[model samples]
Target chain A: MTTIKVNGEVNIQPNLAEFEFKEVLSSDPSRKAVFLLLNNKTTGKAAILVADKNPFVEDGSVINEWIKDAKLRNLAQNDIYGSYELLMPEKFNAVKSSLIYPATDKHILKYRRREVYMIYETADDYKSITKPSIKESLFNLDWVYNFLDHKAETDRIVFDDPDPNIGFMLAPDLKWNGVDVDNLYLQAIVVRRDIMSVRELTGEHIPLLENVRKQVRRVVKEKYGLNPNQIKMYFHYQPSYPHLHIHVINIKYEAPGAGMTCIFLDEAIDNLKIWPDFYQRATLPFVGKEGDVLLNKFREAKRLNEE
Target chain B: MTTIKVNGEVNIQPNLAEFEFKEVLSSDPSRKAVFLLLNNKTTGKAAILVADKNPFVEDGSVINEWIKDAKLRNLAQNDIYGSYELLMPEKFNAVKSSLIYPATDKHILKYRRREVYMIYETADDYKSITKPSIKESLFNLDWVYNFLDHKAETDRIVFDDPDPNIGFMLAPDLKWNGVDVDNLYLQAIVVRRDIMSVRELTGEHIPLLENVRKQVRRVVKEKYGLNPNQIKMYFHYQPSYPHLHIHVINIKYEAPGAGMTCIFLDEAIDNLKIWPDFYQRATLPFVGKEGDVLLNKFREAKRLNEE
Candidate 1:
């Protein structure tokens, strides 16, 4: 296993191991850290954290932390349920940027592209995308899994039943048999271009530029109604992929990726104890739709980086 | 402050409360124990746990627990997250002659005649139903509370977020914060119903239906291309609206509703946690585009029920 430890936990690392595990996001595990793969020969000693997780990339505290903590630990039996296993690289730093809403023309272009991708070629495309195979099963959630197996690459499919209520999603091939059966949410793969545009900016920029991490989060939430707490973002500086994108994964309520909430799940539910407010606050960024305000800031920063 | 002690737990008697809460069609929380209203000088004090945490029921045990537990505390502290406290009633004992399916010509006719009582109508039917204000805000969930405040209810609305990835049934006036939000990923909902119905029939059901829960989860992974774990289900139940239903909400990896996966805004997500496998095993009698196999089962069940 090639070990690569990235910066603050925004960059996601998939659990390709035989079991499930959690890595810290920040100094205080509740904050954000990097997810690392600990191995001697493979990817070498490296770090992976989402660029979005860092607000200010230049700060020595943050930078030095990345430089100093450059070791990857083999996921111990106990680590499976602790943190999301995220780490950042030393070369990268976070910078805040101004808010710049996508131009109408640009919005139209993106929409059209998405529309084309959705519509595709035939009636079957529409049918397959819209129609759900709601065949009742005896034991397994087979239809969902089957659908995932088939449509793992192309489109996003949603299934609905009557009562006009509960729904589900089918992502690509994600495995969990015994060691990591509990945390069964999808793992999102994000690319670097999704967040950064390294242009040059001379004038005073937004102070929030340092906090590019939060901006990426706001965009993801606004565009997709993903809750931050349930999901963990991973960043990378070219250990595997070239661009620096954040991989966001959904950690089911039952998943140990919950950190403090895990404490609540372990303690509060049965004890009837109140969930610590900090857990609630910490996970607040994950609720609702992604906020554009944050996304715009990142986009502006990217634009300035290019200029 | 009407406290009804059940199993020695001081719960605000859901039955006696302003918003009725029930436990309908559940496998666990066996529906045998009688519940007293503590201070109900009005209706019969004796109540029973009705349902398990099934996805089909709007407010299953999951909803009731959260309201009686978390939200209630939040309300008391005056944290004021949003309006509309969710509740799960004790029984889904209200036997209905027919369960309407959203498909088939007959279903539509029945919906027009028996179920849908148009309390309000719009001059421009299509226009009113697909109003820009509602359309724009449907997926744009960040403005949820804001939209609720200004949404006009002069016409009945059926949510269809242009992007089929999301579906909702929002009745602003029908909510506590003066707005009720019920969003579902359409395809996934159908898959969940089928899975739930199948479980209802099969005796071998997990008390906590996590394994089977993946039926609908596939769509988030493959179809919409989301992090599967990122999708969260929120559930709520109200006796005034007899029956059960759950709202399927997806939290992006970094949005606000992330960390607290178990924390349901309403009863929509929780109820699914405990739904009996019998419900998942059972099927819908009517067949239509929406019903899938559940409809076929429903038809069989209807015949059996009639016989």
Candidate 2:
């Protein structure tokens, strides 16, 4: 084992073994990291050492293909799907000498690229710019229809509500790996096909909304042992698919698109109750990612307050 | 100079000089990081090298007291306040060899601890729980008053509106280092003292809100060359301070409390227009962090559906 030593000028010398393991601060099984608090034996100075599993790289030449001395423990098996904990040979560990490290240029670029725009979508803009752009070809709902018809992912469905008007089918979202309970994520696909998005909802749809919320809370509690308050239910404005669906996630899970893009189900219900024509008349604001067609449409229409 | 080499089994051997500098992918002056795309001369494989400045550690013994070959670049200077870029010698660099890495237990714990709870606050809950708890002892507004009176941060103030009823003072938030224009952040503190938060806003405050919005946009455009659409104006539901201050930020900046805790100024205006008593009667949902007194109050009142 190669040992690293630090001098008064904080120079890295490669001969002396200085670190003596004191205690483990934290451990993450998923990330495969253990933060160990160590004391320098010679100088008696405390230091934090992060021992993490190295991630796979895109370069094929750097990776070793052989899986030597492999051991597998079955975690769960359902139908053809099986989850296992694999123990392999010669796993490389990346050690971070300390937590205090300057962020990389890639990190800054990533942050810079995450520039979000809030589009103040008026009713006219929705009709002229949004509605026309969302052509049927934009999203392929054949798979969604197939799933609703029980022709796909039949085994994965947690519960199905057959009522066509005031019902939805609950299923684990693809994002959830079905392993971590703290980061539980589920989706409720409505039975009705008429409502394209939250923009289409009215006071008449209150029952449907309430029913979905109630059923979701009940099933989540019964199945996952998660209380109603422990989970958040919301809808995406520019949802990935045209089909109306509600995202039900554990409160602990801070999913992407939760900020400016999400509208709470409870807020929707209350708004509808307050005004029957709330969705129709209200100038809604939603985030548009860079280079989105809808955003381009807004730009072309001169809807954005840009110079 | 120390060199690292990798073999078929990916062992970290510290003798061979294998990497050759190819190109610089990105650079962040603020983070002091440079991402260099390198090619292994011996193996003819490409790799990403993140050259980052080592951060200051808490342990005093590990730090060097001497500063050699130091240089300073004055970026800006204003009335007893100045900003400079410091260049110091013998700065250590931390290198990350690969992007793929296993998350550690500390990362999981940190993510898990960010569990946000949304409280469905009613008028009764506000009166009985929220209002009574904020007994003026919670937040000391003396510094704010001092600033408003031109006794503090007077040099930092961008502009001031003296009208007590429909006026505010715009200043850069302390959180903004004032170096990065992309992550520009400013605060608009209302002149009037009666209004506590968004909850107090009715149709009467439309002028105040609109004035703040307009002035913020105009000043930002004139001074920073940022268009109206490139910035966002919002209010924190359970604000850090009771004073009714609006947060103005660049679209690229994603502040910590921007999610469920934030209420857009436009939304507030729209809601107030829709119903004069919208804030008064509405079941406002705001996020409460873990161990917050308000969260505890909600728990005691059994407002949360936790078991």
Candidate 3:
């Protein structure tokens, strides 16, 4: 299994590379990150949506049922808006917490439905169902990668990273000592089952992939003193997670700068440039420091359980 | 004798592949410019020390006698402290017109002496003199040539023209506009005798050199508007007229703005990279347009006399 580490926190997932992560509640930092894992039903684990609280109920199915019920009532609200921020209990089965409201006043019943969970049978079902989405995340990742590699070159050029599993891009907005620096972009596929299955297919060792992620986190934190905000860790086919491989992605949007740095594909980068389709377009919202803190807490809890 | 033309202007030096022109001192809208002529010495034209503005005195004998007279009287007041500015006209019978002063207050008479019509005994005599330089006006033409040849490039960078004879450089002191347009370095070398000699030695024709300078100028002006005081051009040896070659270089000290166009050296600038040493260290000065007006007026008067 590929273990993706971001800013020193480890995230475990199944062998599949594609995944999407997001934040459903505006107030909860621990539950701030939500992920959508997808692969063709022919190859990937069954689609399951997990909550920080009720890990088994699958929030994806609950959200789908709620949407259908709301449509029957002809709610006439744009509930499928890409992003909806609300205040509520962190999880589903928590003792009756006061219903949190959205910025708009319309949804009293929806407010009572605080955190919904659900599941889907196919990739198409997932795409058709979710409006505020994680499915389109991978496509955005590909776009950002293309832009960073071709046009962003300054008088001083930076070298591209050596690993194919891990792609690191600097944010255009980041700066050091008043000089604009690029924000970082990183991607890696995670697996939960046999690591050898991935190695035989992609010809890359799973341990090497994990090590690269750890190195990236150490370098970024120690050298740049910043963290990714939208972290996407994709997992498929559960026992929730132990049966899955987690592919981790870090994306920081609205990064603070105007400079762009190109990732040159030279002789040194030849081998890394050719990657498998599974690793293509899998993107995650990079969790910045707050998200990183939650991830570290999760990793510590998992490590203690294993011990 | 490969004449390189950027647009339509013909550069005259084999060493120079481009020219950029700017008027350093003009409130007028016309933006007229002047070119300095170097190596204009004629074999039989009587290099004279004009006590009463005569042009027919002996080249060496009369000059030496006059220098002797000034040296004896000014040995204490002039010799120990006073510079070439004080002794040049009195001793050598050369005019030190107030046309070519730099922006600085502390002027060096030694440098200004080079501005006067000093004779080069032989090409080697011209080669040996250092303080009163004649090399830059000859060398920077090579730099300009390299700058224009799409194949021209070198790790060697220039902050200021090394050879005053080859040409001069200037940048706009931008205050009103928030944007810095572009840094401009200009050089013009006038060659009647030296061109003839280099042609014989290198087996190259002279007209090819003339065409290159004109092309560089046209490209720069078309790309960036011919803004007054935004740039400056220096004529190599304008004291004597006719045969002239110039190297004009301009680089933006600060970015003008987001939309401003910068005439960048194309990636293919390698032609002048392999030139021989005939164009190195030529001496010339970067002077302003007030000086240009005086020199232009002088050239017009001489041209009228010739006609």
Candidate 4:
């Protein structure tokens, strides 16, 4: 096995004994990667190394070779796809290494199982369909409150504005691996608890929206060297949580759940400026995933047709 | 070389000489794939074959072997990235096959070169920045008129409505290669020439939007067997061309240029129905690519900050 050291440490052919084991920064089971922070004892400097398993080639010869050499322990089997832990002999090593089989696609679509339905939500539909669903979910705000109070993810917070009405705390999203700057993704959760979603926003909240947008851009520029033009800010209509938040992502990174329910922050502010009751009076279209409570409610109300 | 035959023709070991070349369905140079229609003389039936070059394994040995044996003919070199034609010896054959080098990424992003800027275009900005740029470009409509007149893509038309006020012609988008139903993408080009973009849309055009939306859904359902819930319909705020069109795509397919500038057709109709001059009164936010005239105008007018 080759000992590869990245981040300015030379001696690519150094023996594995020369390096001291450190801590694992992160591990992604789906991608079969373990990011390690190692110290090169010879150089007395820290080196970052990504121990990632190579993907199988699509060639028949490669597949046959893999099948011949692999000892698989089945994890699960459902229909056409199956999951397993493959223990295989390394190229120049006697020891077998274990890797998860049925490796996830590189460009993973998180909502592949979820079918998106565009629901034309009226104010009445909000009352009958969305509002009740939100109430039923009874989303606890303790975690959010903890984060705002500096009891959670304190070290991860990039920017924190304490002005209750127009303030938000920006932090790196859990989806990001924290290594790749190209795929930089962040989320800014509003400090105000009153506004649950974009549906509740009016011209009165334009300052909050603008503040988040401006501060996010400035902080990203200062910290990450990414220009304002190289970043995108948008709010999800049917967000994972009902709490009002804005997603900030590098323009180069194609974030999942971007197009379906995403509404640009600038567009939202512009609309509110034109008509203070724009979101209140307008018929908003949102994507509802399969088996969602709100989706069922929409179907029951005849707002969305039964499939 | 193994002559693999697909599409239920059996006899995977058939000689290459036994198959008669009919025609090429599509050839993607970037992906090094040639979709060919072949006739199996032995079976007396047509067969589809995709002759694609396998992607390189990220292993050091594989890359070293590739570099040692492959012959390259340079196409172009710009900075770090270069394009080439690779002629390499086949595994078991004396014949050398040709393939384009620097194979494009499978999930190809179209706007890598173009920087996306969120330009806030007010009514005045539209007149000063957008209108002049459109006028300056003088986008020729002869081809569009020709298509409308049945001089082009007549066979490709999936749905056609003749009402000039509320009519549109639906056809497969150029981006989608016709074979893959999972990636089914279509465009509905409006018949009326007066309405140029979403900016020009008003409450009066609600009927037209609804008609297009309804007929498109019906046609996709009838012809493609795609449920209304299985497809997404949207309009690009800053469309490729000035002429009005709505993009219809399979909800499963992550279409390029989707997340950016895409507004739901349902939302547009709902907005128009509620506010007679919703689009007219709203300040629009759109993405502007590098070197775009409107982008330059926006920069000059201070609508978008200079980067």
Candidate 1 Cα lDDT to native: 0.25
lDDT of 1 by residue, B155-259 (tens): 433232222212223332232232221222321122121222221223332322332234334533454444433445433211011112234343322222233
Per candidate, the number of residue pairs that clash is: 191, 6, 116, 0
DockQ of 4: 0.11
Alpha-carbon lDDT, every model:
0.25, 0.65, 0.25, 0.66
lDDT of 4 by residue, B154-199 (tens): 9888889989899999888999886677788999999999877998
lDDT of model 3 at residue A31?
A: 20
Across A242-280, the per-residue lDDT of candidate 1 in tens digits comes to 222223343332222331221111111211112122111
> What is the C-alpha local distance difference test score of candidate 3?
0.25
Off by over 4 Å in 2: A1-115, A135-138, B1-115, B135-138
Top-TM-score candidate index: 4
lDDT string for model 2 (A1-307, tens) is: 1222333223232111344545555443223344445556666655443434333332323322211233334443333222334333332212223221122334223333333577778777778888888872477788888889999999889889979999899989999886677778999999898888998899999999999988898988898888787888988887887888999988766564455567788878887887777788777778777667788888899987775
Q: Per-candidate DockQ versus the true complex?
A: 0.01, 0.08, 0.00, 0.11
True contacts kept of each: 0.00, 0.16, 0.00, 0.18
lDDT of 1 at A145: 43
Per-residue alpha-carbon lDDT of model 4 for A1-307, expressed as tens digits?
1423444442133233344545444443223334434455666655443333333333444333433453434443333222334433343111111211111332122212456677778877876678778978999888888998999779888899999899999989998876667778999999999888898999999999989988888888888888777777888877778889998887766665554677778878888887888888777777787778888888877778434
For residue A291, what is the lDDT in candidate 2?
Answer: 64
Give candidate 1 misplaced runs (Cα > 4 Å): A1-307, B1-230, B235-252, B257-261, B264-307
TM-score computed on alpha carbons, candidate 4? 0.67
Q: Label model 4 with its docking quality class.
A: incorrect
Model 4: pairs clashing at backbone N, Cα or C within 3 Å = none
| Model 2 pairs in collision | A27-B105, A28-B105, A31-B102, A31-B103, A33-B104, A55-B100
Better of 2 and 4 by DockQ: 4
TM-scores, all models, native as reference: 0.18, 0.65, 0.16, 0.67
In Å, residue A226's CA in model 3 sits off its true spot by 11
